[model samples]
Target chain A: MTGRHPLVGALSAVALTFLLGPILLVVGVAFTAGDTIEFPPRGLSLRWFAQALSYGPFLEALRTSLLVAMAGTVLALALGLPVALALGRGGARSRGAIGTLFTLPVVVPELVLGYALFQILMVTFRVSAFGALLAGHTVLLLPYAVRVTGSSLAQADRSLEEAARGLGAGGWATFTRVTLPVIAPGVAAACVLSLVTSFNNVPLSLLLNGPGTTTLPVAMLHHVEFAFDPLVAAVCTLLLVLAVAVMLVTERLAGFTDVFARQEADRWRP
Target chain B: MWRRRTTGLLLAPGLAVLALVFLYPVAVTLVAAPAGVDDGGLADRLGALAADEHIWRAAARTVRVAALVTALCLLLGLPVGFLISRSPPRRRAVLLALAVFPLLLSTVVRTYSWLVILGRTGLLSRALTGLGLTERPTQLLYTETAVVIGLTQLFTPLVIITAYGAFAHVHPDLEAAARGLGASAGSAFRRVALPLALPGVLVGATLVFAGAVTAFTTPLLLGGTRTPTLATLLYDYANVTVDWSSAAAVALVMTVVVLAAGALAARVPAKAAPS
Candidate 1:
C-alpha cells in the first residue's frame, strides 16, 4: 500500500477519539459523587461503584451473566469443534453448504433469533429461562467457534499428522496428540470470543430473561428504563474494565483484529 | 469411507443441538407468522399489517436509518481501512485494536454512554453551551440523530476491519503503477484501489445495514418513543401487546431484508488481487 497521507492519519485519529469518547466518558462519570450522571462528575468519588456492588439485582445479574457466558462458551466449543473438524477434513465439495448451515445463526438478526427462541422455549416447551438463555447463547456463539477452529484446522500443517500416522499411531491418538495441540490456541480464542459475545448480548438476553434470571445487560436495560443514575454508570464502568481486560488478553494470545479478518476470509473461501 | 463416517459422527451432535435450539425455533416462528388470520387467511394478516400505518412507518424508518448508517460507515471506513492497511505492521495492529475496542463493550453500556453524552445535561450539550453555541442545552437525546450516531459508533469498526482485509489484498504496487502512468494519487486510488476493495465495502455495508435495522438497545435508549424502528415494534408486539403473530411478521420482514442484503453483498465480486 502507498504510504498514508498525513491528512488521512489525522482524520483517522479524530475518528478513533469519537469512537472511544463516549465509553471513556461513561467510565469517568461512574466515579461521580453526585447522584445524577454528570460530566466532570461533580467531585470524584467511588460511592457509585460501592452502590453497584451492593445493588442486589445488579449483583445477581452479574452472577448470572458470568454463569451463562461460561456455560455457553463451553457448549459452543463442544458443538463447534466437532463441526469444524468435520468440515475441515470432509474436503471441498460440501464445505460451502455445510458451513453456511452452521453459520446461519451468525447472520440472522439477534432480534429474530431471540424472538424465535422465546416462542419455542416459553410458549411451546415451557423451558426454564436460564436453560433457554444458555441454549440461545450457545447457538448464537457457535458460529464463532466453528469458524475459528475450522480455519485453524484448515491451516494446520498436514505433514505432522501424516508423520504421526506414519509412525503407526491410531487416528484418535494422532488427533489427540497432533491436531489438538495445533488447534488449541484457536479453540482458546474461540472460547474468549464466545464469552465476550455472550456476555455482551442484549436482544437474546432480553427475550429469554425471566424474573430472578436476568443477565447483566438485560438488567442494565431494565434499570435504565426506570432510572438513569450514576449507579448504572458504575456498573457499566466495571463491565467496561472487564471487557478491556479480556480484549487485552485476547490480543496477547491471538491478535484480536485477525479474528474479524479471518472470519471474513473464511466466508469467501470456496 | 471411514473418514466420511467419522465426520458425520462428529457432526451429528452439533447438528442435533442446532436443529433443536436454532433451526426448529426459527421454523416454528416462520410457521406461526399466519397465526392471527381470521377469515382472510395469511393474506388477511398480511393485508392487516400492510394497512397498519404504524407498521409501515416503522419499517420505512428502519430502512432509512439503516441506509444512512451504512453510508456513514462506508464514508468513514474507507480512509481508516486504507490507513490501517498502509501502516507498518505494528502500528496497523494498534490501530485495528483501538478501532475494535468499542465493539468489546456491551451494547447497553455503549448506548448508555451516549445517553450521558447526548442528554440535555450531557457532554455534548454542556460542550455546546460552554462554547456559547446555544443559549440552552439542546435535546439531542431521544432523536433519530442520536440513534444514528450510536449505531454508527457500534458498527463502524466492523466496516473498517472488513475493508482493511479487502485493502490488504490489493497490491500496493497497483496504485503506484497507476501513479507512474500519469494518474494523480486520488485518481489512482479511485481507478485502482477502490474497485478492488468494493467487495469488502459491500460486505461491510451489508453488516452495518443489517445491524442498524435490527438494533434494539440503541434505538430503545437513544431514539426513545420518538423513533420506533421495526425491532422495537416487534418488541412491543411480543412483550407489550402479547401479539406473537405480529411480532413474527416483523421478525420475518427483518429476516428477509437482512437475507436480501446478504445475498446482494455476496454477488459483489471477490477482492481482485493485482496481477
Candidate 2:
C-alpha cells in the first residue's frame, strides 16, 4: 500500500501543512513592524511587544487575568473536590443529575450563564462584591474540577483504597493518605486547564467584571470593539504561546490519552 | 454506611451550584419572560417572540450553520482520523498530540489564529493574490464561510478522534476473517469492519453536532456582527440589548434545540448505519 497508494502520504502532509500554516502565520505577523494587522509583515520589530508591555490597560488586564484565573482555579478545586468524592459515594440517579449540574459551565453558552449570574448577583442578592464575581467564576470553574477529579477517581485503582482501609485507615484517612496522592496528577492537569479556561473566558468576564476586575480576555474584547491596535496582536501572541505551552505540558504529563479518551478518540483505526 | 451520606453530601455542592448557576437562571427567564412590565399575562413578550420573523430567521440560520459545520466535521474528520490511526505507533502518538493541541488552545487563540490568516490583509489573502486567483486580497473575513471554516477546524478533531477510536477498536481479526473468505480489502473494510465501528461514528456525529451549536467564541469572533447563530443571538440580547428576560427565552430555545438534536443523535442505531 505504501508505494501503490502514495496518496496517503501526500494527504497526511497536506493536512499538516494546512493546520500548521495559520499558526506560523500569526506568529510571523506578531514580529512584523507594521502598525495595522498585516500578514507577511513588511519588516521585523519588537515595538509591538514593547507597547503591549507598557500599555496600561493591557498590563492591568494581564494582572487581573492572572489573579482571577489563579483564584478561580483554586476556588474550583476547593468547591469541586468534595463533589467528586460525593459522586464516588452517591446513588446512580443522583450522580447523573449532579453531573448534569456540574458540567453546566462547559456546555452552557458563557454569555447566558454569566448574564444569569450577573443578574442574580446584582438584582436578587444585590451582592456586587468582587468576591461574588470570584464566586461566580469559581462556580463555573468547578465543573471542570468535578469532571477531571471524578474521571481520575473513576479510573483509580480501588484496590489501593481497599488496601489502605485493610491497613486500618479510616475512610477520610484513606482518601487523604492513599487516594489524593494518586489522583494529584489529574487534579494538577485539571487545575492548569481550569486556570486557562477562566483566564481566557471573555463573555463571562465581560458580564462579571467591575471597575478594576477586568481580565485580559475581556479587555481584549473591549479593545477590539472600539478600534484595532498592534498591541492586540502582541497580547494575542503571548496568550497563544502561553496556551500552546500549557497544552504541551499537559499533554506531556497526561500522555494525551486521557484528554483524547474523554473526547472519544479511542474509536479510530489501528 | 459512611458512603451513603458521604456520597449524598459530596454530590450536594455541585448539584446545588448547578441549580443556582444553571436551572435558576432558566427558571427566572421562563417565569419572568411572560411577566414582563408587571401584572401582564403572557401577551407582551410571548406575542413579540411569536410574531418576530427575525427570531425565526436567526434560528434557521443557526441550525443551518450547525448542520453544515457537523457535516464538514464528518467529511474532513473521518479520513484524517483513519490516516492518523494508521501512522507508525511512535509518530501516531505525536500526531495525536498535535491534533488535540487545538482543543486545549483557548477558543480565543484559535479564533484569533483564523482572523490572522483569513483577514483581508492576512497571509491567506496574500497567498491567494500570489497565486493570481484574485487581483487584490479578497474579502474572506466576516462571512458565513469564515464561521464555518473556524468551527469546522475547531470541532473536526473531536470527530476524528471519535471516529478514529472506533476504527482502532475494530478487531483486526474481524477484518482478517472477512479477507480470508475472499473479500477484497475494500469489501472487508466496508462490510465487516465499518459496521463494527458504527458506534464511534455515531458518537462522533453527536459530539460534533452538539459542540457546533453550543459554540460561541469562534462564531462571534469569526462571524463578527454579520452572521448571528443562536448562541450569538442570545449573546446580543443578554449583553448588547441588556435584556436578560429575552436572552433567557433565546437561551432556553437554544437549550431545547440542542437537547433535541442530542436525543435524535442518540437514537441512531450502530450496526445499521449507512456507509
Candidate 3:
C-alpha cells in the first residue's frame, strides 16, 4: 500500500498507456467520417453508426452472434448442472480428476479447441454450424455454470437439505425447493458470464461458425477486412460497458469471492 | 453405499452432457491425430510435422511471443496489483473492474481498435507526425509489436487478478516485523513481500503465456501476412486450406506444450516467497 518506488509508477503508466490509450483514441477518431482512419478529426458525424447499422452483413452477423450465444448458454447450463451436482457431491477419491475435466476449457487455448472441434464436426460427424458452433460454445460455458452452481451448492446450509430429507420431502422436491433456491445467485452469475463469454468469443466462433451463420465477432473480422471506422470502436465500447455492468451487478448480488470459492470448494468437497 | 437414485440421476445427466459437449471436442482433436489426409492415422500427421519446417518456425515464433507477453504481463501487473491493494476499499471495485475490462471485449474489436490507432493514417501516427517525432508513420500495426500490445492489453488482467491475490495474502505484519529489525524498507519488501507474491505472479504468467501464444484475432488481423503465430498457422490449415491433418498435428503440439508448461510451473518449487 505504501508508495515508494519509481519503477512501479513507470510500469503502471506504460501499462495504462497501452491498455486505455488506444481505445480512447479510437473512440475519438470514430467521429471523423473522413473517408479513412484519420487522426485529427476532420469532422464529427453519426453517419458511420448509421452506415454500420444499415449494413446488412454486419447486422446479420450480430443477429447470428446473439442467437448462437443464447443457444450455447442454455445447452451449457443444462449439461453443466449435472457435473456440478456430481462434482459438488461426489466422493473425495475422484473429485479432483473430475474437477480438472470440468475446468479444462478455461485453460486450453481457443485456437486449439476450435481446431479440434472443426476436425470433429467436419471429418467425424459431418456437422456444420449447429453441431460445431453451438457445441463449441456449450463446451466453453460448462465451467462457468459448474463453478457458479458448485460454489453456491457448497455454501448452502447443508443442515437445511438434511432437514428436508429427514421430513420425507424426497430428493427431487428438496433439490427444487431447497438446494435450487440457495444456488440461484450462482446460477444468475453463471448465466450472465456464459452469455458474455459467448458474445465476445472469437477464436472458437471463427473456426466453427460457418457460412450464413457468422457470429458478431467473426462478422467484425470480415468487416475489418474491407473497412476501418469508429463503428468497431462503438460496438466494442458498448460490449465493454455491458460486461462491466454485468460483473458489477453479479458481484454485488453473489460476491466475486463466492464464485471462485465455489469452484475451489466444489473441487475439494468430498 | 447410500442408494439414492435421485443423486445418481442428478449427477448422471450433467456429467454426460459435459463429456459430450466440452470433453468431446478436445478428445476428438487428440483422436484426430491418428488419421491422415488420405486414410487418417497418427503416422501421417506426425510425419507431416516432422517434415515441415514452416510449422516448427511458426511454433517457435508463438513461443517467443508467448514468453515475452508473459514476461511483460508480470513486469507490469505486479505493481498495479500492489497499488490497487494499497488503495482504500471504496475504490477497489472500480480499479478491479478497469483491470478486467479488456477481457470482456472481443479480440476482433480490440484488434480493430488497434487497427485504427496503429495504422499509417491512424490516430497515433497522426499525433506522431504532428509532434515531429518521425518523418512518416512507422510500421507497427501489422508487425509483432502490435500483436504483443494487443495481447498484453487483452490478458494482463489475469496477472493483476492473480498477483493481487498473492499480494493480499502476505500479511502487513510480516513486512512490519522485517522493518522492526531496522532492515531498509526496500530490502524488507524484496525479501519478505515478493517471495509470497511469486506464486500468484507465476500463475498469472502461465495463463498469459497460454492465451497469447494461442491468440488468433490480433495476429490474424494486426499481424498481417508477415507474422505467423501458431494460431494463425492452425487457421491457415483448417479454414484456409482445409488441411485437417496438418492442423490437428499443430494443435496437438500446442496443447501438449501449454499443458506441460502449466502443470510444471504449478509444481515447481523455486516460487518460494519468504516471510
Candidate 4:
C-alpha cells in the first residue's frame, strides 16, 4: 500500500503482459478457420482441436507423456522422501555434502545431462530408451521432491516425533503415524511439482526418447519441424489448460510457490 | 547409533540415484572430452576449438544473448517484484501466483508461442505488412533478436519470483524510514531497499544467464542454424554432424562457464551494501 508508485505499477503491468501475451496468442491461433497460423484467425472454429485429438500419433504421445510423468513422480517421491527426512534430521556435516550432491543435477546444464545419459544408458549399458527416459525424469524430478518435502519437514513439529519416541513408539511407527501425517501436505505439493516438471521436460525426453518412447513435447517438436499448423496450437492450448489446472491445484495446496522461494533463499544462505 | 542408521537409511535411495544417474553420467561425460582426439590431448582439442572462428562466433552469440536476457529480466522483474513485495498480503499472493504460473507451462510450449508470433507467415510479419511498414513480410525468425525476445519471456517469470523473495526480506519499513528522513521516493529505494535486495536479484540473474546459455529448445527453434548458440551448436554436433568429440568438448565448455558463474554468485557477500 505504501510503496505504490504509479510508474512501478504501470511498468509491472507491462512486464506481466510480456510474460503472458505470447501464450495468449498461441491459444488464439488454435481456433483459426484458415489452414495457416495467423493472428485475428480467419474466423473461429473448433476444427483444429478436433483434429488434434483425432490425430493418432499425438494421442499416443500424450499417453506416453502421462505414463512417464506419473511413474517419474512416484519414483522421485519414493527416493526423495528419504533424502528429505535425512536432511531434515541428519547430522549437519553430512547434510552439506549430500545436499550439494543432490543439487548438482539441477545446477548442471540439462542438455549435457541428457547427452551424458544417452551415452551411458543407450550406448554403453544397452538400456531401452523408454527405461532411460523414465530414469532421466526421475533424476530431474528428485530435487523437487527432496526440496519441497524438506521445507515441510522443517516446519513440522519435531516435538511430536520426539514424544512418540519417548512413549515407546518405534522409529518406523513414529514416522508413519506422526511425521507422515504432519507433512502430508508438503508431500502432496512435492508430487504436483514433480509431476508437472516431468511432464513438460524437453531436453532429457528429446535425448532419451526413441521411436516408441516419444513424449508429447518431443513429439510436438518433431511435428513443428515439418509443419507449423493449427493442430500444434490446439495441442498446446490443451497443455495450457492443463497448466492452469495444475496452478489451481497448487493454490489449493497452500504456499506451493512459497516453497520454491524458500529453496532459492536457502541456497544463498551460508 | 540408532539415529545415525535411521538417517542413513532415509538418505540411501536418493543418494544412490544421484550417484548412479546424475553424478556418474556427468563424470563420464567430462572424462570423455579427450577421447575425441586421435593422437592429441584435451588441451590440443580445446585449443583447436578456441581457434575455430565458427565455434567462437556461436560462443560469443550465446554470451551476448544471455547477458541481454539477464539484463532485460532484471530491468523488468525488479520493479514488479518490488511492487509485489510492498503490496498488501492479498494482492501479494495473487501477484506471486500470476508471476509463477508461466513456469508451470513447458518451455517447449512457451517457445512455440514465439515461433507463432515471429515466423515469416506469423502474426508480426502479417501485422507489419498490414501496417505498410514493409513491402513484404519481414524475416524475424532464426535471428539473434528473436532468440533474445523468446529467452527473455521464458526467463522473466523466474527472475520475478526470485526477486520477490529478495525484496520481501527487505522490510517495507526500512524504505519508509529513509523516506521519512527527507529522501525522495527514488532516493529512498535506491539508497535503502535496492542494496538490500541486490544479492538475491543477482542469484536470479545468475540463474537466467545459466538457463539462457543451456536452453536447447529456444535456441534451436528461434535462433535456428543461422544464429547458433552453444546449446544448439551442441545439438548440431551430436545430431547433425555426429561429431561426438566436438560435442563433448562443447558440453564441457558449457559446464565450466555455468559453474564459474555459480561460484562467482556464491562469493558475493549477502549484505554487501551496509547502511
Candidate 5:
C-alpha cells in the first residue's frame, strides 16, 4: 500500500465531511424543540419523534414499506437463488448474457422502471395497487439478490457439493444438505441487502402507489412537499438509525462494503 | 445433459420473473411511446414527440446536471478512494463502511438534508449571510446547482468505492518505483498509477453519470418546478399531464442517452489494467 500521503489524507477528510455533513445536520435538526426545522435548536426535545410515531399516515406508510420490503425480499430470493446457483456452479458459457439479462432491470432507470410497471400493472393488467408495488419492489431487488447470493455461491466449496454427490446423494439432496448451508451466510446477506434497498426505494414505490398504498419514503416525500417541520426530520432520523443498523448487520453477515464495492465494479466493468 | 438441464431449470424462474415484470413492461412502454398521438400514423406520433420543445429542454438540463455531478464526483471520489486504498486493512474496512453508509438511507432522507442546507432559510444561506458573503439569505433551492450538489453528494460514495477497488488493484510499488526514479508523488500517481486505474475510474464515472441522468427524487425535490430534468419531465407527463405517450417517449430518450453514455465510456481505452 502507498504510505500515508498527507495531502490525500487531508483532502479525503474534507471530502468525507462534505459527504456526511448534511446527514448529521438532518439528525441535529430532528432534535429541535422548536416547532420548525432548524439546525441549532431553540431547545432540545424528542417531541417531533413522538409526533412522527403518533402520525397515522407515517405509521400506515411505514407498515406498507415493511410489508413490501419483506415480500419483495422473499420473492427476489426465491427467484434469484436458482439463478445464482446456475451462474455460480454451472459455469454456464452464457454467463455474460445471463448477467446482462438480469442487469437490464437495473441498468434501466428506476423512474422509467416505475412508470413502466405502473402502466403495465395498473393500466394494462389491472393488478391491485399493493400487488403492483410489491412486484415493482421485487424487480428492483432482483439485481442484489442475484449478485450477493451469487458471490457467496462462487466462494462456497465446490468440492463439498461434489463429495455429497459422490456419496450417492441426488442433486436436490446434495444442494439441500451441502450447498445451501455453505452459502447460507451469503443468502442472509442478500436478504438484508434486498430488504433495505426495497424499503428505502422511492421512485418505483412513488409511481406505483395508488389509493391507500404509499410506502414510507413516498409518504415522506409528500410530507416534505408542504411541511418543513421537524417531524419530517424526526422521521428521517429514525430511518437513518434503521439504515445504520442494516449496514452493521450486513457487514457482519457478508462484509457489505466489499460485497457492494465489488458488485458495482464488476457490474459496470467494460 | 443433466447438468445443462438443471442449470436451465434453475435459471428459468428468475428469467421468467424478469420477463413478466421487467422486460414485458419496458417493451410495452417503447411500443406505447408512439401512441402519444391518437388517430395518427406512426410517423405522426413520432413527429409529435420529435417536436415537443419542453422535453428537449429537460433532456439538455438532465445531461448538463449529470455531467456536472459526474465530474464533481470524480474529483472528490479519487482522493477518498486513494486514501481508503492506502490505509491499513482494518481502517480501510471501517473507512469504506463510513463512505457507503449514506447509500443505505433512502434518497428521500439524503435529499431532505440538502433541502435544509440549500433552502432560503437553510444552513448554506445562514452561513453565507453570517460570513458576510451575502447581504441576505440566498435561495439555492429550485435550481440546477442545487440538483447537481445533491446528486454529487448522493453518488460520490459509489464512485469512491469503485475508485478504491480500482486503486487497490493498482500496484503501489509501481508508484514507489516511479518516485525512486525522481517522479514526485503527484507525477508518479498521474504517470504510473492513474493510467492503470483509469478503466475502473471511468466505469465509476459512467455509472454516476447514468444514475444522475435518470435520478428522480433529488431532481424532483431539489430542482422542483423551476428546473426540469428528464426524470421530472417524465413524472409530469405521466402524473400531471396524464400524457402516457409523452412519458414513454421521454423514457425512451432517457434510455438512449444512458446507453450511449455507457457505450461511449466502454470505447475509451482502459489504457493499462494492472497485471
Candidate 6:
C-alpha cells in the first residue's frame, strides 16, 4: 500500500469534521442549562434530557416508531430471508429479474412512494394508520434484508449442507443445523440495518400517520416547526446514540465494510 | 420438482408484498392523475398547472439545489474515496465506518443538528461573529446556502463510498504504468483513474440529486417558508390544500425529472464497461 499523502490526510480530517461536527454539536447542546439552544452552554445540566423523557407526544411517538420498526423488520426478515435463500441456491435465470424487482423500493423516491401508498391505503383500501405504516416500512426495508442475507447465503459453504444431508439429515434439519448457523451473522446484520432504517424513516411515516399515531421523526418535525429549544436537541442526541450503538453492534457481528462491499458487488455484478 | 416448488414458495410472500404495496399504488397514482376533472381534460389541467409560474420557479430551484449538492459531493468525495481505497485494510474499514455512521441516524435528527448550527444564535453564526467575519450574527438559516451545506454533509459520504467501490476495482498498476511512461501523478489519475471511476461518480451523483430533489425535511426546516422546492410544493398541494390532482401533477413532474437524470447518467460510458 502507498503511504498517505499529506494533502489527502488533511482533506480526510476536514471531511470528518464537516460530517461529524453538527451531530456532535447537537449532543453537546442537549446538556445546556439555558432555555435557548446555545452551543457553549451557560452551564451544563441534564434538564433538557429530563424534559425530553417526560414529554408526552414525544414518548408516545417514540413508542409507535419502535413498534412499527420492529414489526417491519420482522416481516422483512420473514419474506427476505426465504427469497435470499432461494436466489442463492437456485440456478434460475430469473434471479436477476427477481432481485431487481425487490431492489426497486430503494431506487424509487421515498416521497413518491409515500404519496402513492397513502392514496392506495387511505383512499382505496381504507387501511388503518398503523397497518399502513407497517406495510410502508416493510417495503422500504425489504431490500436491505434481502441484499444482506443474499450475500451471506452466496458466501455460505454448500458442502456443509451436503454433508448434513449425507449424514441422514432431512432438508429442514440440515437447513436449521447447517445453513442457518453459517448465515446467522448476515441475518443479524440485516435485522439491525433494517431496524435502523425503519426507525429513522420520516417520509413514509409522514404520509401514513393518522390521528394519535405519529412516529418519532414526524413528531420531531412538528415539534421543530412550533418550537426551537434544547429539548429537541436532547431527543435527537438520544436517537443519535442509539443509532451509533446499533451500527457498532452490526460492525461487531458482520464488519461494516463487508456489508457495503457486498452491497456494491450485488449492485454491480453482471 | 421439490426444489422448484420450494423456491417458488419462498418468493411468493415477497412478490405479494411488492404487488400490494409498491406496484399497485404506483399504478393507481399514475392512472388516477387525471381523475375527477370536470371542465377540462386531465392533460389540459396538468398542462395548465405546469404553466404556473410558481411551479416553474420551484422546479428550477429544485434542479439548481440538486445540481449544486451533487457537484459538492463529487468534489469532496473523490479524493477521500481514492485515499480510502489506497489505505491498508484495517485503517480503511475504520475510516469507512466513521464515514457511514452519520447515514445511520435519522435524517430528521441530522437536519435538526444543522438547524442548531446554522441558526442566527447558532454555532456557525457565533463563530463568524467571534472571528470578526461579521460584526453581528448573520442570517444563515432559511437560505439556499444552508440547504446546500446540510445536504452536502449528508450525502458526501455516500459519494465517497460509491467512488471507493469503483476505485477499489481499478488496478493500481495502470496508474503506476502511466506515471512510469512520463505522465505526472495528476495527469495519470485524470487519464486512467478518473475515467474508470466515472460510472461510480455518475451513480453517486444520481443518488445525491434524487435525494435532494425529493428531499422534504431539509428544505422545509433549513430553507424555511420562503424557499419552497418541488417536494414542498407537492406536500402543500397534497396535504395543505387537499388537492390530489395538482399534487399528482407535481409528483409526476418530479419523478420524470429524476428518471431522466438517472437515464442520462446510466448512458454515460465508463472505461471499464464490459463489451
Which candidate wins on DockQ?
5
Per lDDT, what order, best first?
A: 5, 4, 1, 6, 3, 2
Which residue pairs in candidate 4 have backbone atoms (N, alpha carbon, C) closer than 3 angstroms, thus clashing?
none
Report the number of clashing residue pairs per model.
0, 12, 9, 0, 0, 0
- After aligning candidate 6 to the native by TM-score, how far in Å is the CA of B48 from where it should be? 5.1
Q: Compared with the true structure, what per-residue lDDT tens digits does model 3 show for residues A1-270?
A: 233457666776677667777666666666676767665667888776677668787788888888888898998888777678766764545677777777888777778877776766655667776568888888888888777777678888889988999999986798899888888887877887788788888888778755856888887787677766566655665565666676667678776543432332232122
Deviation in Å, model 1, residue A79 alpha carbon: 1.3
**Residue-wise lDDT of candidate 2 within A1-270, one digit each (tens)?**
111135645655565555556666667777878877777676999998888889899799888878888998987898788888777645555567666666656555566667667666655666664655676678767777877877788889989989998999998899888999989888886787678677767767766667767877767766766665566777777876876777667777775546544533422110
Query: Candidate 6: which stretches are off by over 4 Å?
Result: A1-3, A91-93, A166-168, A260-270, B33-45, B269-275
Pick by TM-score: 2 or 6, better one: 6
The best-first sequence of candidates by TM-score reads 5, 4, 1, 6, 3, 2
lDDT per residue for candidate 3 within B11-83, as digits (tens), equals: 6766776676557767766654424335264676788889988899989888888888888888788777776
Candidate 4 residue A217 Cα shift, in angstroms, is 0.7
Candidate 5 at A82: error in angstroms?
1.0
Residue-level lDDT of model 4, residues B68-167, one tens digit each, is 9999998888888899988889999888888887888888889999888898887789889989999888889999999999999988976888788888
Candidate 1 lDDT over residue span B1-275, tens digit each? 78778888888889898899989888767654423322233454476577678788888999999999999888777789888888888899888888877777888998898888899998889899999999999999998999999998888887888888888888899999998989877787788888888776777778888889889999999998778999998898878887765677777778888888877767655433332
For residues A56-89, what per-residue lDDT tens digits would candidate 4 score against the true structure?
Answer: 9989999999999999999999999989888897
Candidate 2 vs candidate 3: the TM-score winner is 3
What does chain B score (TM) in every candidate?
Answer: 0.91, 0.86, 0.90, 0.91, 0.93, 0.90
> Over 4 Å off in model 2, which ranges?
A1-5, A90-93, A129-132, A260-270, B30-45, B176-192, B269-275
Worst 10 residues of 1 chain B by lDDT: B32-41
Whose TM-score is greatest here?
A: 5
Tell me the tens digit of each residue's lDDT in model 6 across A35-152.
Answer: 9888887799999999999999999999998898899999999999888988888655599889888887876677878888888876668888778888888998888888888888
lDDT by residue (B97-207, candidate 2, tens digit) is 676666655566667778777888777888899999899788788898998888887787787678667777776777778778888766776776667777777778877
| lDDT score, candidate 6, position A168 | 100
Using DockQ as the measure, name the better of candidate 5 and candidate 6. Answer: 5
What clash pairs does model 5 have? none
Looking at model 6, the pairs that clash are none
Q: List, in the given order, the native-contact fraction of each candidate.
A: 0.66, 0.36, 0.51, 0.64, 0.66, 0.53
DockQ of 2: 0.42
